[model samples]
Target: MNELKDKVALITGGTKGIGLGIAQALLSQGIHVAITSRSAKAAEETAKQLNSSATKARAIGVKADVRDFESQQNAVRLVLSEFKQLDFVIANAGLGHFASIEELTLEQWQDTIDTNLTGAFYTIKASVEALKKSKGYYISISSLAGANFFAKGAAYNASKFGLTGFTQAVMLDLRQHGVKVSTIMPGSVSTHFNGNEPDSSDDWKIQIEDIGELVVDLLKMNPRALPSKVEVRPTMPPSK
Candidate 1:
């Protein structure tokens, strides 16, 4: 586990929600991190605050549009520039666009698929080489929706389901190279996802820090062990 410390990580959409939670958890473990967002200011501000914490783990905020391969590649470049090594990459930048097939717009469908699915591919393509060099870990924050279907969730379901399959397949392709890959699918996380602000009323939802701890634990697993896919749900949700 001592080897886990002092590693460098790059997380997409790390300015808030699950990404930020994961960053804090890793930083406390002495890992340097670079988090990206669509908004430059938000990313910079959040990075500044994290750096100010006594953890003393360096943090950098980068502006990136995960939907674009070049943007993701640039983020990778920035992370290497800062930390000189890449150890962990989290493809967490995702957005949901839910609507019935009849109501979903072309733009909405494209945006959802591009950001959640193809974006993950771009991240992996850009970082896999660096990760291979360090025998690093690649984790994607997926959703239970990848397996469960609901009405008016065509786009979101497609993206997550694709993500689950994509990450798993890549896991097989990369394991021999010594890079561990995993996907975390949470039932419902209390975060500012889909524009819903988390409140005390959201106690029933899975907390972001729980997901963060899960990531750290995965990193600490024995070299011979690989839990490629994880399913996490709230112990209890409001009784319905």
Candidate 2:
């Protein structure tokens, strides 16, 4: 039997892209998963697809918005009610709005910060107790933009930077409880973010499954070692 068999995970914004990829990977490793989305239809359909592909493990859909604390609390409650234990939580819901600082609207900036930064805060807060019980893991999907700044990326950069710092601090706060925390910072991922539809041209970028594999590796590592933060990038990119 798989050592991770029957472990459970809750993934925020898991209806598509990176979140969906991680759900699939965990299910394959015999982990039950609850995937949340703001859209009820997308969450349910994606869960159905994952269930069909998985062998022993199961998947469920939850309609939750990470930006709202109550909604995140409800998601964690529902997962614990169904799975009886929570072993991992991945904060993967995020968005980017690119424009010059002067052109960035207040609404865009707020949405970016709320969804990418505050949302992660809510996710971990909601799930922390459950994780402490299971000695589980928490992983946030941040980005390379957290460390690198560029014009027209004000909102995105701010959110990711804040998320990276937040996860590190939380790691210190939770390590004594036997819970592990880490943030994944990926560069040039081929996901449908920032209104960019994935296509063949994105082949050189990091695939969602690649991130999925990385999450699995982190979970499977020995408990004595903690990779507090990880930065991932495509091996090669078309030269400028």
Off by over 4 Å in 2: none
Residue pairs that clash (backbone atoms under 3 angstroms), model 1: none
20-80: candidate 2 lDDT, tens digit per residue: 9999999989999999999999999999999888998999999999999999999999998
Top candidate (lDDT): 2
Model 2 Cα shift for residue 104 (angstroms): 0.5
Cα RMSD to native, each candidate?
0.9, 1.2
Error of 1 at 30 (Å): 0.4
Give the per-residue lDDT digits (tens) of candidate 1, residues 171-215: 999999999999999999999888898899999999989988999
Residue pairs with colliding backbones in model 2 are none
How far does residue 177 in candidate 1 sit from its true spot (Å)?
Answer: 0.4
